[model samples]
Target: MNSAGTWATVTSGISFSQFENVLGVLDVPAMSKNTFLKKEVEVEKVWLKHIDNALVEAGIEERRLAIEKGDVDDGMPFITVIVDGGWSKRSYGHNYTATSGMAVIIAERTGQLLFLGVRNKYCCICDRATKIGMEAKPHLCYKNWDENKPSTAMEQDINVEGFKMSEKMHGVRYKYFVGDGDSSVYAKLVQNVSYGRTIQKLECANHCIKNYTGHLHKLAADKTFPPDSRKLLKQSIPRLTAAARGAIRHCADEGETVDDSISDLKNWPYHVFGEHAQCRNYFCQKVESNENLKIITNAKLLDEITALVSRLEQKAPRLIKNKTSNAAEFYMSLLAKYNCGKRINLGQRGSFQRRCYVAGSERSCLGTKPI
Candidate 1:
């Protein structure tokens, strides 16, 4: 067993019934038994041994981060765990489909579980399960007097809030986190990670598959070169990303129209027009055809381009002043849009390094942020 030290967390998925309140609390800090002291389902009854294995499995590398779960914080040992009652089971076409709700636990040291609640993945999680007004604050959330369920977006917000509260109690740091398959839940948590020009180790996580952008697929089409040559090109993906972003920006700035004739065709092919190929070519044709002649990696040119954007935003002429907002917002949108709740997921050369995918649609999400 890993030694109990700094902070540790355990998580599990359970049925709604298992989330019933016993000590006036639902799941964490203490699991409230049902009226008849009902026994738990085999799946919900995960043992400490299993939690033990999971803790190590949850570790960053070969060893665990915390000596024990209790060392989280003195007053509030913020912990979050999930029961991945996925929404995939639900059918949107049919009349309706039932789904087991996701459950979570937030606890403190001495094994006192603080918060326990179940939330449905597809339907409304903001409903009050009981008819009672909020009796007390249930772990940074309002617990209605008679409800067995949460009253806000607490199901997802709690994890975000727990980290904040724990940080407030102690100092904010990535002690440890426990989560499951709910992509939405994970995305909310990842937004808290640090990302900028300098920070090397960004705190993030995701399970979403990275999908390649149109421009990358086309770039990789040349298979004539042997494996070694292609490997070299792949390694220099930073060049690809930088080149594409620069080309797109220049073209857009000049109002150079790139025809998207294929994007709206009646039956778009699965691998249509190559990832970002049309856009990249359009950029090259417009303002700077010489931009990518010698560029080999997206990495080498990053500092220069970033500095250019910064200078343009700070000292560009008045007529072109507002254009900086477009530039800033475009990348900001990309950062948020490309991420699909996967932990530390990244893409390269306009395609997913591993998988290319986006979660639920957010109309406002536009382009990637500087990571």
Candidate 2:
């Protein structure tokens, strides 16, 4: 029965009723829903204990690697980590009404989950009790977020909590953080978490390039630009994306120093537009003929592209590191498999957090010995 309940939550994201129906279809005897719920409580306890142990082991390994890599500062180990946040419901980048949100921190060195947290804005028992105008029964409530706070605020809050507890939980500090372009989380960390040193923010390479692509697409669809300019901008999207990605790869592979990589990245826009005077030979052979180059002839379009390049240049230092939050993103994707597209309200009874524990344990234990 406990195994069945575990499967229902970790693999199927099905309620006990759904599991019972499946059992009935198979002509197999199933435990009562009340009994199943009791077993699920046990399952949650076991998974939580396992996840705690796994995180501790991962932290130890991360610290050892950081020291070996000379990432320590003044005898204190500092590791670079990737972080990302996800919501129970899809916001589509506009709507922010998800009742639950989660964020995770993964060590860049070991690709292991260091910390994870979830926030909930609703609790089934509390809401039910309120509806009846009576005192709620004592229960493990999952509601931590205030009703007045926006759902979007959950990400920053969870991230701040994770950062503040890093040293205490893992015996190491997250000196460098690789996250998406969101500045609010980083700003909060700078203000709240006191590691007795500065925490540097590293921009995710993929997000940076993605944002650049989005900007070009937005410009292409704008009516203010001349039709010719818009057409040129549309045509330049693929080329610009390719150029940016190639530049990042080349810089990462061949550049001797971070400064060299930044210089190379800053010069890529000019090279793509047939202004190769500053181009490196290794990057572009500088063919004598400009006939093959799709040079932007529109002055306005050229200015816009130049401005975009300048904006990207300002982020060159962060991009040169080439660090990414892909691991954290992958963990979120795995989490979606368990949560099953927000179709069920798992947050009401602390079930959402237990599911998260399963996901984190699966990720942290992947290709590793079982705890």
Candidate 3:
């Protein structure tokens, strides 16, 4: 194998089973184990033979699906229905244990990934959360340090027999490439990226503000835009501010530092230069940096929130709590009620007017009354 191939193998995750040898044996009721085995075998057979075969025939040598468009789903698209056995760590706590796995489905649509992870059994009989085909398809997998072979998470993941739905769309045109069909991880990544995308969606406040400011600077130079377009911007300015505020508030709910978050728009290289400038993708170029990424990730979740609030200020001049009032009473309560070291009282008793005096100001001692 080539150098890159060798590296890939070294870093690649272990096989799906990753569980100990089942000795090709089990003790579940004949009905349960029998049914499970048949379904498992059929899934693997189809995945390896159908999906794998089609992708390879079209143009694929490996299954480490990456973050891009894969060949279209064949009418028989590839599907890997995975499941897990009780053994997570060692397989069998004793000398040996049975190997178990789950099977899920996969397919290509509009160049993005689509996955369906199903669960078969629930840890507790009363826990409906783990039941098979439990709607919403939310991932219920988890890890059990005490288990042997199949990790706790994997065990839940493999219960159901997931499969591709629209085998009909074998030939069509669409957009967006789903990253390495890691549906679970991909879904989260897509969400995170989408959130990032929203933040970077448009230069509403700063961009427009800067543009307006620049326009003022160039008032004497070639002024071509009609007054109506200028009016459109002025009107849009408020919406952008609202959007910025929403972004900050939403990020706050996630316990994230909305300010430090980068703009997803930055990723759309075209934003900086090209016909795609107005396109959401192009306009959504995100600003990425270590400090910023941390905020986006809500790693420490420190000053980022304040920064977001500051951005909110820039976006919506009216939203700024320049004066103390009860308008944001509910939001203010969060500061006092939060586990974090957020200050609840403004040192004065009245209502929240502006953003808590910007954290650390010598004037904070001035009491609840306006300084």
Give the poorly placed runs of model 1, Cα more than 4 Å off: 1-43, 48-118, 121-155, 164-172, 175-371
lDDT of 1 by residue, 1-99 (tens): 111100011111222233333223633443342311222222122332343343223322211223344434444232322212221123343523322
Off by over 4 Å in 3: 1-36, 57-304, 309-371
The lDDT of each candidate is 0.28, 0.79, 0.27
Over 215-316, each residue of candidate 2 has an lDDT whose tens digit, in order, gives 989888888767866776687689888888777776766656667766766677667666787878776777454532343544366677767767667887
- What is candidate 3's lDDT per residue for 1-371, written digit by digit as tens? 22222222112221112111232255322223333333433333333343333433222211223223352343222222111122211334353322222222212211111221222222222234445645433432222122343333442343211211222222221112211112353233224332212111112222333333343234213235444433333443444344443433444445544233334112211222122333343224443333322322233222322343343344332222111112122222322222122212211111111111111011122222321
Candidate 3: C-alpha RMSD to true structure equals 26.1
Ranking by TM-score: 2, 1, 3
Better lDDT candidate (1, 3): 1
- 109: Cα error in model 1, Å: 22
- The candidate that wins on lDDT is 2
